[model samples]
Target: MDIQKDQILETRVRLELDAKDLRNYAKKATGYSFALEDIAEHLESTVELLKSIEKLKSQEEQDQYQIGQQVVYVDEFMPDTVEIITSIVDGWVSFNNGSRGCIAVMIRPANQDEIKANKRLMVA
Candidate 1:
């Protein structure tokens, strides 16, 4: 079954953290079988597979945006804010304010109207 990329990323992060903890426990536990270490290795390998499955933004999507392009960012706590794309890291859109997340989900290319409105606000 298909899992969302964000979900996969979150699960991979949690699994990696758990695997680190398991390795630490294995190191501290005396007279224990290698089972814990083996399990940790399995979890780590699973994380690798998850990394492979997690989808990055497509080349087409990347080409549609540029470092100086403007975008409208929206999150649960705030209204749409016009921001510049400062960078794109591994297909994730980064904004001038140092905020970044899933593009088109929380951010999108700002239309001409929005950009013009923001420019007017800045001039006011």
Candidate 2:
């Protein structure tokens, strides 16, 4: 399966992370097809690094990551404040008393003419 770089998540990633962590969740889980042979044949990195990362991720035994729980940063959707993504409805994600007191915001999906009006901004 072709993976979108944007949607790829990690249990723990660095700042502005926008990369996917392709690893198995459990012993019974279907493992990733990214073997050292595959990496050597297809990508530039050495087999050792590949094996190392694979070992680390496997030893970690992580789950499907959550939004704020060690997010792989996407520049397009990087929220300065990191919190558990409480709820997403109709494309709008609700935050818990977030920056600028923005409790509610209009939805902004990727496709279509996605735009939002700042409704929570109080006029002084």
Candidate 3:
């Protein structure tokens, strides 16, 4: 068989084994025999749900921030300094200095005016 078919067969076999194990556990724990087919169906649904959740998480991270984008510090002290986004983390963003330094700022998107003003400040 081809690679795709082989992988599908392997996944099905693993699911069947997992369902059987669950059924055995249920029988031992509650003195009742759970249907193997039902268990397998539930497991498949759970796998699909997990895949969807992972996709959403990845999209959320992408939407949070982008590298090389220009943003402004939300501080009164340097409110007009244009900073280039270099990296983003859970609660902060890292910026590269126009020359050779780097600094981290809060992860906040700046408006167009703020970015333009910062650019003007840098020029001045």
Candidate 4:
């Protein structure tokens, strides 16, 4: 069987099972018992994270900038930087330096067009 197809079928079967049934199936399959509550909690957290991502996607479709919004900037040679919007004046935006007693850094706001042209800038 194709590995990707097998994974899809396995995921479908797992999604159909209830919390109790999933715990029993896990025990029988792996010989290790897992708490139903723990499984349910994990599933809930995963769903919540998905919902959050969806919300962020919709917000990104609308506008990337809002006062006090948090966004992540992707960097090619370094780790992604997370910054909070501190102020916006004209077409420029200022982000908190993420350091104690540091001044905010100002940069021109990148609109959707700019983001489409340059993939490095992103809004989380």
Candidate 1 residue lDDT tens string, 53-124: 764424445667888888775554535667788887666777765655456446666778879887322211
- After superposition, candidate 3 runs with Cα above 4 Å error: 1-24, 27-31, 36-44, 72-82, 88-93, 97-106, 119-124
Q: What lDDT, from 0 to 1, does candidate 1 have?
A: 0.72
At residue 29, candidate 4 shows an lDDT of: 62
Ten-residue segment with the worst summed lDDT in candidate 3?
97-106
Per residue, candidate 3 scores C-alpha lDDT tens digits across 11-103 of: 656765786677667666643445554675698776565555545554564466778887664555554566677765642456773332233
Which residue pairs clash in candidate 3?
none
Query: Candidate 2 on 1-124: residue-level lDDT in tens?
Result: 7432222323123211212222222222354454533433333233334445545443332223323431212233444323344443333344552322221221222211111231212211
List TM-scores for all candidates, in order.
0.49, 0.19, 0.40, 0.28
The model with the greater TM-score, 2 or 4, is 4
The global C-alpha lDDT for each of the candidates, from Candidate 1 onward, is 0.72, 0.31, 0.56, 0.47
Better of 3 and 4 by lDDT: 3
- In the predicted model 2, the residue pairs found to clash are 8-20, 16-73, 17-72, 17-73
Tens digits of lDDT, candidate 4, 38-102: 77557655555555554454444335467665544433453234455676443344566433111
TM-score for candidate 1, residues paired by index: 0.49
> How many clashes in each candidate?
0, 4, 0, 0
Sorted by TM-score (best first), the order is: 1, 3, 4, 2
* Candidate 4 TM-score, C-alpha based: 0.28
Q: How far is 26's C-alpha from truth in model 3 (Å)? A: 1.5
Cα RMSD (angstroms) for every candidate in the order listed: 6.7, 15.6, 12.3, 14.8
Best candidate, TM-score: 1
